[model samples]
Target: METSVFTRSIESLLDEDEYRALQTHLVENPESGSIIPGSGGIRKIRWGLKGRGKRGGARVVYFWAVRRDRILMLYA
Candidate 1:
């Protein structure tokens, strides 16, 4: 399921290939992102754009829902 914010905002930030790569990375390494303080269990990871490095990339915020075995993508 996709939220309106994700579909409208986040989806437009990346191309199809970049989005797929992000999804694949998340699926393989759910906890790879650094944990954000005071945000419960939320974590943040960087994603580079096609012509940019990770430093010039976007920040993807997500949460690992262990009980449900799901990763909730909160923001980007």
Candidate 2:
């Protein structure tokens, strides 16, 4: 299978912690791709999200598939 390269927006979205898990997920299993129909072209790819640390904060991590044709690693 051919792998798509990631976009800059998607790259910028990643924080230090987020990138760690995300990178591993991609390296180990990058074939997983979720498609979103009729999304104005912005694919809702389920890359996976993370949670806040034990320090206590609104842990709301999100995975997103930003664009298509061009590789876009989506996240929140």
Candidate 3:
């Protein structure tokens, strides 16, 4: 996984298992998130926290580069 300062900061807030699960989910379904308009194709997915349901989960913003098979996780 590629890491940026922003992403690393967000990752710091997640447990190891949560981070791994998120990585696996994105790899398995790159198009899982909804595209953000006017953002050059950035996408956002709502990920559930340990005890929180989807309604209270964190928002993960990312960009999926299909050609390179890379997921640029931007924010959380």
Candidate 4:
């Protein structure tokens, strides 16, 4: 996974455990997120906060680089 785009400020959006969970989920299912229309294959996944449900959670945007076998975490 290429998370260099996820800076300190971005990481702060979620706690350590939440971030780790996101990473694990992405690693296990990189193409599970819904693709964004007209974004050149970018995908988005909803991640719930510790107490909130998916509706009130953050939206993680990423791209699955199939050819490179990598996930490019873009935003959250």
Best by TM-score: 1
lDDT tens digits, residues 1-76, model 2? 1223343344555566776765565545444444445554333334444464433322212233333323334333
The true-versus-predicted C-alpha distance at residue 61 of model 1, in Å, is 0.6
lDDT of 4 by residue, 1-76 (tens): 5456655435767888888888899989998899999999999999988788999888888999899888888877
Model 1 spans > 4 angstroms off: none
TM-score of each: 0.88, 0.35, 0.87, 0.85
lDDT of 3 by residue, 1-76 (tens): 4557646766666788888899999999999999999998899999888788888888898899988889988888
Pick by TM-score: 1 or 4, better one: 1
Model 4 spans > 4 angstroms off: 1-5
Scored against the true structure, residue 72 in model 4 reaches a CA lDDT of: 86
Question: Ten-residue segment with the worst summed lDDT in candidate 1?
Answer: 1-10
Residue 1, model 1: lDDT of 34
Query: Which residue pairs does candidate 1 place in steric collision?
Result: none
Model 4: how far residue 44 lies from native, Å = 0.4
The all-Cα superposition gives candidate 3 an RMSD in Å to the true structure of 1.5
Relative to the true structure, candidate 3 reaches a TM of: 0.87
Instruction: Write the residue-wise lDDT of candidate 1 on 13-48 in tens digits.
Output: 898888889988998999999999998999899999
Worst 10 residues of 4 by lDDT: 1-10
Note the clash tally of each candidate: 0, 2, 0, 0
* Best first by TM-score, ranked: 1, 3, 4, 2
Q: How accurate is candidate 4 locally (lDDT)?
A: 0.84
> Which structure is stronger by lDDT: 3 or 4?
3
Residue 21 Cα positional deviation in candidate 4, in Å, after optimal superposition = 0.9
